[model samples]
Target: MLLDKDGILQDVIPPRPPLQSLDSLPGSLAQKVYASLKQAILSLAFRPGERMRKSEICEELGVSRSPVTEAMTRLASEGLVDIVPQAGTYVTRFSMAEIHEGAFLREALELAAIETVATSITEEQLVLLRRNLRIQEALVRDEDIAGFYEMDAQMHELILSFTGYRRLAFLAETSWVHVNRARRLNLPSPGRMQATLAEHKAIIAALEARDPHAAREATRHHLRQLIKFLEPLVHERPELFANH
Candidate 1:
């Protein structure tokens, strides 16, 4: 059962859908399982700290224990799961420290990326960015919060891609796994989505103008918004967070 902010028992989490066949998927069985489980965890289908039973996962995915074990180990390494000896595996609880560290790294890498691309960004890239923004606007109008969040990530990634640094893009993707959880939790807040769209526009504008300083400031400002929005949530939903 899930617990509310007042620590009362709320509705139980429903069973997740069985994993589909991997025939058309691009990866190995283990990789596909890992991706599906990670998406479920990040999407909050598996609540924070909820136990993840291997037998159940094996049954759900129609796979053997080998691939499930491999997926769990990878998730554990990504800080998204905890495997305790003789106890069980569970979804990792939220950690403010980890979130902040992710934010810090994201700011550093993205700021550098934006600076590097400021003067050298091509028109095609600019068009791609604008197209992304237009899609985000439509998503916002439709109140498709989840779609908007995905697009938001894509927008930042487009900026980072201009740097031609594959490692930097990889780091940004990794760091966002932690930060994205916080954003998902806080997404229901009113006006947060609109605010994010405005912020993205600001950053894009600065980059288009070739003003690295403005772009850096805008990027820093956008990254910090998540922390500010999370302060009250951390207090209200203490059960969702870890002491670390």
Candidate 2:
């Protein structure tokens, strides 16, 4: 096998990368760095309230300071981090109110989209969704946390795509980054993982049946599960989140 100068495998049937809403991002230094860092944060690679040092990040990512700075700034603007004067940047903390707001907003918007697509879902879209669900189930069964999370993100994206609203999909994705950190925290529990998989199955069934109310209810139910999980975290660990 051919090897690059760094001596790592150039090609070894590269493993499929985990899923995230940022997967379809455009090509650019800023976008690349942003997606990378966003995924890291969502996957809990960077802990909540953890300080982010620009110099260290620059070296670690093998990129210049500008792109990393730009990425961090964008993340900060998204409420994923706090940049303070005379203090330093820190990963944003989780807040119960914000979590509730995110769930309510996502439920409203996504339910509307699901309703719109209930009758309009094409055969191809349904097929792809089935494939995604299969992958999601397999990942969950294997306890492949990263793969499960990725499939979950993609399933949401797929539903939005079927609604034929790129702008809505983009907005939905931006909203996901906030919830993702919380999800990463909550998902390690076996009970939570099992419930999540069950919820996904319920959603898939509702969508397949082309039942608008059922689809909407399924979506709302899943998000409510997250609310239950995050409320305690918010109360138990105020240090992990900013002012709510």
Best by lDDT: 1
Compose the digit string of candidate 1's lDDT tens values, residues 62-110.
8999999999999999999999999999999999889989888888888
Candidate 2 segments whose C-alpha is farther than 4 A from its true place: 1-26
**Residue 117 error for model 2, in Å?**
1.7
Give, for candidate 2, the lowest lDDT window spanning 10 residues. 1-10
Best model number under TM-score? 1
Predicted candidate 2 versus true structure: per-residue lDDT over 137-240, tens digit per residue: 88877878778878888988899889887799878766665776787666765466678888988887888898988988888888788777667656555666
Error of 2 at 75 (Å): 1.8
lDDT for model 2 comes to 0.76
